[model samples]
Target chain A: MDRQLDQLLSSAGRPALCQSVLPALLGCIADIARTLRTSHTVALAGTANAFGDDQLNVDVAAEKLVRDALAKCPAVVAASSEEDPAERPVRHSRDAGQTAEEASSEQYTVAFDPLDGSSIIAPNWTVGTIVGIWDGASALRQPPAERQVAAVLGVYGPRTTAIVALRVPGAEAACLEVGIGDQDFRFHVIRSRVRFADPPFATRYFAPANLRAAAESPSYMRLITQYVGKKYTLRYSGGLVPDVVHALAKGHGVYVSPVTAASRAKLRRLYELCPIALVVECAGGRAIDPVDGEEILARPLEGCDDRAGLVCGTTDEVDEVKRELLGASLESCR
Target chain B: MDRQLDQLLSSAGRPALCQSVLPALLGCIADIARTLRTSHTVALAGTANAFGDDQLNVDVAAEKLVRDALAKCPAVVAASSEEDPAERPVRHSRDAGQTAEEASSEQYTVAFDPLDGSSIIAPNWTVGTIVGIWDGASALRQPPAERQVAAVLGVYGPRTTAIVALRVPGAEAACLEVGIGDQDFRFHVIRSRVRFADPPFATRYFAPANLRAAAESPSYMRLITQYVGKKYTLRYSGGLVPDVVHALAKGHGVYVSPVTAASRAKLRRLYELCPIALVVECAGGRAIDPVDGEEILARPLEGCDDRAGLVCGTTDEVDEVKRELLGASLESCR
Candidate 1:
């Protein structure tokens, strides 16, 4: 390796924060993805099944990866999951001047879906990762609605994009884009103005099933049909990577689900499967409970239990769907 | 890029087979897996109720990756799970020696579980690829089982391991082996000498529900206590990658579901997950069909839909389980 390149690689390999799970997961997954692309075998170690269930799912891998990344970091506390039966134990490496509480307290704890859209794997469908957060372990332990930390979802396809929510301080959100096919690539957050500058849906929709529902309403269906009839395409893949990429490229589509009864029905309420709902909302799009049209509560234990309803998209478009569904039938409300 | 490195990369990019739907699936899956590992956004195009009632699993971005890899191959027919209700078209690529007879005649085809264990993506479990052969398009045109020609399951884990089988001119039946994992991975054929290599007890017994019942059998219980006792360790991870890997490493285990009453009562019939069973048999283990104790057939389907029985390390172990189950119940066999 060139001296400069070696230095650069070493720097890249360095842990970014004391609570370094994110960087570690990012590095590990990147290596695995590249190896697989180059037609080589890739492996990951760290977390095993804490729940002791025989079934394999993304939660296991995601938790494992996150925990491994954070293994060296002492600041992160309670990197937890809806799927995990227990809170991850902080087996952090010993460091000087670190109290047990300070070592375990997460300045930032990331909850994630390490690999999403996994059911399609046997047939070779695209999969993705979703990561978001709440205040800390206390907030995470709270029911889903009570926690209020920002989040992000890194959806992978031919390229990978990150929808990041800046939680503290300014508390703004942005979309970070990375092209995997491009050899020398870097991430650039989609500008804030570009994220929320337009009316969410002035035309047809291109969305993943879950997000489409969370972000729109039944009345929007009329608009969607009109838009499609005018040559707009309503495209969606079961894989989150493809779905989010299409939405990102097209501009107006909701990258996540819309909050409306009809829309939620459309999504089949796969809450954790598409954490992009939080990502989309944080990035200036709408995130809501489709049936009630309420803002989505961050870190809500109740809403993300593999059974809660969620929706995301531009605010106005989401409202339209909710209005239409509410007007149509009370049954739709449930 | 270095010329040598570029050449190696290009060669790595080459499609493996000449005439099959596999090239596309392989490339797409490999790319998506790479993208996921690398944390890049991936997108798919052209998906809508194509292969079955559900959307075809392939899309535009995935197709491009597949095409680029297959550009140099000698493929006759290129089938994809993504294309709209159509068999893969035959190519006139010069390398394939396209001729009147060749173009019109039925050609070989491949069926693939391009991405396996994907459901675990959300949970981060081991995922893999499953490829199989079909004499023609018959298996694909109608049902799953009809298309198996030769089959292999490629699992993405700590190491890439390919559990493969071929029904070639081997004097008699199919031969199975672990072709992709371990630095010293070698194909070892099952011979009578090693056939009973292990103890008389089933080496690995999973399917806890069924095993518990088998353990309750008075005769089987006596045998386990007297012979197979403490050494028996029940191991099963819903993820096939680990389960198969563990079984391969450990030698023998029973993974039967007890489908039929007689088979269930006797605890003998575990032939359903053929590839797994084949690997065991090829590795000098015994896979029983419980009901008839016939040579287990790998069902030509998507999942482990067959009734279960016993998988043992040695013939003696299988016989012990069989004798207890069939003691006087042979006439009751289904």
Candidate 2:
């Protein structure tokens, strides 16, 4: 299984940076998946994150696992997590005395949402881990399109699977779907080149996140009505990772999390949005800012807590969302 | 793990019938879960079922596994499945020559949707197996409230879990949530008495299936608007088993599959609706026919192909759905 992942990365022209970082990110994901399956009872941690969201025991544990794994990777100089928003220096055990400046030249940074859907985990629903690997000492103040080298969306569902997107400096960008074996916890390539379904599908699917935003945004509400009228299947799981991964797995679908005045978007750009956008774009889909209707990858990460509304999935469906949600206002401006 | 399940059933006064049937039913479910986790590739069978829904290779395999397992349970005299919607006599190995009439005295019948969410399975999303155990040679022409002795909803998700509801003739009805261990494939009781969350929850959830029906029924449309307007969390997964299971796991949610002129209900009464209704009701929730707003358990199964709209979940939420969807018309009639 590991061989398949190695082959996929090699075919995509693996940079030395990804070679050091991917294993650490994926290893933590595997550990988390195993822990989730075995630990039947997940308790509330009696604490909240910086964002004031309550943390589960599993969430805290997963965040630690990710941090610990990244600390072992010599090339991963800095990392930020959703649970802990501050970007911290990751000092490898082998190079304990290495200064931040000395490591800056060949260093990579990571931003991860260790456990993305903790709200739904108590119910034993499928959650996920999102990791974005940036080719720098830190991910701050840089657009994902320019700095993000690879991203992994690890899905903990009926089967542990991942959508890995690699965009090294020189090679062709690739998105690969791999399944983790229960016994070995190793990833085996499921689909080497994951892409959205060719257009004109018989039944289209949509995952409309933050449906509460509909009450405030008439356009968002109308878009949902249009989708229902068109007989598009609804597939929201209340988890950003699974919802977006659905589009990648099925090869079709749209996932929209709109930010309205009444319902502010909560998905962080550094930990969640950028990683997801990288994977979606790599899969031949589109990921865009819901407000401006621009590619999400083009947005720069201002800080660890940067949040945004996302409209992502099949290219045409995303285009349709932008047109329906922003068309009237844009036309009025014109 | 098995001990926990045995204890749960024993506490509910396990009828000699469930002793033979439960093991067989759950064994098949565990087998299916294992198969689902391991099978990396699932292909289309290139054929459709009696309902004209395309079947996947995994779906076909699951149906056969269920039938084969039931064939070993001497007490399970007959069985029917969604794939093959005809009642067939299940002949045990030791009782190969036993006539259906001879076996009928102590026999139980089984109706199952071996794989409830084949459409979403291709996306590597969580799907499930639903089994309803009836205390008779056949399940036709009897209400689930009287005939359904036990029901099991096997969830194949990030963690393999099952909600087992037992309603034998004499003992108190009980609902249990159990997790299936990956290694041993044994059932471990997670929640012994799975009940809906106590009322007055801060955040309510709703899974509105067949959203297309919203276009045909103004009442259904208004109900959805009310849910969104009231800020109910959307948790639909386009899969019946997981959607309903979410309600059980979260302890507060409603799943509505409304039947209208445009969107006819597809959930089979014998296989899908009855089992789910049993589990929900056992969990102190309510399961009702969406049109009449009556308890779903009271409806008699006319045939294996009988299908109906279901509004089930937290008791109060189910009541709210009925009130919103049927209140105006009822008031007009009054």
Candidate 3:
């Protein structure tokens, strides 16, 4: 009755490092989900994180849980989180037994956003966790398409579920959706190979984030107007995780978070955007920067605080974004 | 450990009829929540409802459960649902023991949308059940403010919760938010009294339903433009129940569904709109028809197929909806 996450990872031929790191990460997410059900207190801790967003007691608590869980994984040499945007050594004890060079060769680094939608959590709306696992000891100065081997998105909604994407260099890319049961809290595979619906669908959905940016960018406003004019169903929840997850679940959706002068991009590259990009690509969808129309996975991490706008989901819809937001501008110059 | 729904109703000075009827209704909703967790099938039943909306397997299952539960309640004389838009007799067994007049005097009627947001349920997103209890044998030929006494909205999300609104003829209206625990599946009070945030808040939210109508109605389009320009956070989930529930939980939100020449109103009055209107009004918010600027509760429910657009939430924002979508047209005459 219990379909463990490790079994699924091993059967899918994921890297040994991923088989070990992701389960530990999910364990922490499951614990956080349980705590949220009973904890009624969402009082502000009166402190800000590295990003300057005010910290809630639950946010800080979730970050500690994720950090503690990663520290237990021997293969996780270093980790960074949105709450604390610094790559700190996870298992310092390993330095005593092995040389730094030897440890760095085999271990992996993780960057995560422990709690993504703290603003919506107060209303008991869905929130989530995003984790990106890289192949080396550090996740800096390289594009996500290079060393990012795996990613897991933990959705804490009506049901506790995770969408796992694995891309080891030699093996086939795979996307799996799994759910945690309330009775035993065990992960059971829901969809083994998740993919966006093939084109020519009867209906389409859109989640336009950073809506205020519409006032600053005429192109972004045009995109929103186009989606509504085409009779696209709107399904935004004002949370990056749920908005994207909705696309994965429904088999067709486009989520846009545009960067404008008055409204800077809020999603961090290393912690949030890169991880979600991996999942979307593995699902046979596309993820790109809405402004430049470049692949998101091709963008370098640079630092934990690097932020970018994203346009991702089903391939055709994402292509339309480029046509309206990017191509339209190119043609107007003529 | 268990804060039963009956206890909450009795303590709130609700009528004896509500105390007996609401508990039975919640028991049905809780059962539906459990079914949703384990059921993976979202196949179409190959049938359409009275409104021509396709019926999914889960939707049909939920409607049957609600009908069966109401039949077991001796004091529920009749019931109607979105799936079956005709008022039908309940508890016919009472006819054997008592005369028709005796049964009619003490009994109540119920109208419900057994499963609201069925379209979103396929993705495992949060959907809900809405039930409104009326004072007589039929919920017809009367304004909701005159006879509707109580309502319950069962939210099937990461945690099962219900927002109960009770407004007996002479008693103070009460809106209580309660949660159903995993261990016992019993309702416990989360917020004893739920109300919208007072005006002059730092942040505001909006959920604009039926966005397709924007193409036909310039005022509706203008309303959305104004909301985005004013920096209102968009939190729409394309579901009426969760959209309104978000407003109650966040303490400030305006949910608008406007009717136009091309896009008629989709929300049902008896099964969907009235129940939510009662809950929103009890929470110190306002619910009104978007086109006419009339109070939703004041509209007479002529039959089971009644339909109307809703603009409900915090007092000021609902007022703004009236101003932008209605008042602007009035000003144009000058």
Candidate 4:
């Protein structure tokens, strides 16, 4: 995967942060890739995370692999993950003895969910890795979505594949960074960079209406009913990354999970909402908060653990969500 | 992988029919499995199947492979699949010069869905291959559920794995024929028969209440609403094989799709229902038709193209289906 990015790697104009971050992340891909490749043997740890979701042996092991691999990179100064209760600082590889004042602003903060939807692992369902790249220490104080340098989601299923959405000024919307589809693909967990930055459009047209729609608020339920009445097919696995990525790949499809009566929402802002918002928005689509009536990425970060409802997909589909589901005026929301 | 099956191969009482069919089918596994192991390179053919569902390159290729590879099995006199309009005869490979009278009753019939839920492939959700083994050409006229000798479902996701439920004389009830968590595991696609037939059961419970519930019958809608009200987690992936297999693994859970107004049912009898029904029933679970209150497997064969509503899973879960969803009297249907 690093070969396709040789131009990016050698380019002079690219930001220094991603120049190191992307390649370093490219290196980190192997750890999780190994877990996915050997999925049949990974055991259930017989435990759950802080979120009360079950943890697989692969999930816990992969998270450590990513942290260890990324920590060694001089560019990764700090990292926050759903697996950890708080962010941990990584000592610069080149400046291990330097004080906090000596560390350069060129470093990055990585916020990620090492393994999303871990519950589905045993069933052999599609699960993924999600990461958000932030500029520096100060960038973490604000909603990382606004300053997100890049968003990467690796879906590990029948194939070990990764999608990176880069926000560099001249960068293309999305890149098939570490793909198995390339001619030089290796059988093991090594990187294979194919041609990068082709706008991935949906080959099949169907909105990824989340399965949780049935019990969503009355308005959301009505929206699903309308979609059903209109004959829009469904494409949802229980995983958020795969569901959203499916819509992004197809270039169209709505994925909604509004704040319901029982809870605020299942998706976390830093780990899920922001990173995915960056992905869809960059892919010629929209991601928004239905009730607040604003772009999801544009919203201020409530906290590290903040949650929000999501209605994300193609531009037209989000409009369908706003106008029909939220009962906002059609042309007004559009 | 084949070494684990040494016991089954050397057992003297093993049926003569499976001695050839199982090994041949085992060999055919590579053809379909190659699609998964090399998933990144398999292009999505811009085509749709006869069912109007979009086709993946792997789906079309796998179907032809299973057909071609299984054709040489002397025990397989004929094969039918969801991909084909009708049953296709398989000439005996070793006795090509012999007349039809020379072929003994040893010949068996096979009905299969070479690829199920092909649309979910691009998004990288779990899809599967389903096979049902029958006695002979004359037995094909009988309800497949009643006479099914062996039922096999191969799930291709993070791992290429299969589950087999055998009704052969002296064969165990439910066997983990091919498993990933075993010792002496290899990296290839080979059978690693686990503990044989011990009446597999559901562990983590969740019904695959598909999104079409809103458009389904009022009673079905209410059933979903009640399940949601009670906070029953969902396990459906819009794939029948994965959903059903999840229930079978956990020991109990229901997967039902009654005839909606706009369609008859999603599962076709010959390809999907009969095969899966035989598997679940053989596993000590129940597969029933809620409307008339009969075993789903006991229903007579309508035709090669016939379809039906499904209420399949564990006995109690299926009972909840009959009592709540179908409004059937308690114990009367059982």
lDDT of each: 0.40, 0.80, 0.78, 0.63
**Local distance difference test, candidate 1:** 0.40
Give lDDT tens digits, candidate 4, residues B147-231: 6777778776665667666665556554443543212233232323322123343233445444455465677766766765555
For candidate 3, chain B by itself scores a TM value of 0.90
For candidate 2, what is the TM-score?
0.91
Docking quality band of candidate 4, CAPRI definitions: acceptable
Distance from true location, Cα of A248 in model 4, Å = 1.9
Better of 1 and 2 by DockQ: 2
Model 2 score (lDDT): 0.80
Docking quality level of the chain pair in candidate 3: acceptable
Better of 1 and 3 by DockQ: 3
Candidate 3 lDDT at B177 equals: 79
Q: What docking grade applies to model 2?
A: medium
TM-scores of chain B, in order: 0.53, 0.91, 0.90, 0.81
Candidate number with the higher TM-score (1 or 3): 3
TM-score of each: 0.44, 0.91, 0.89, 0.80
Query: For residues A113-225, could you state the per-residue lDDT of candidate 2 as single tens digits?
Result: 88888776656667899999998888998867979988999888777778889887778898988777766667667787888878677668899999999988899999998
DockQ per candidate, 2 decimals = 0.03, 0.51, 0.39, 0.34
Q: Candidate 4 residues A155-236, lDDT tens each?
A: 7765566666766545554444344431233322222222212334323234433345456566766675576656566665
Q: How much does each candidate deviate from the true structure in C-alpha RMSD? A: 16.4, 4.1, 4.8, 6.3
Q: What RMSD does model 3 have?
A: 4.8
Tens-digit lDDT track of model 1 for A80-123: 55445344545765542355544543454545555555433322
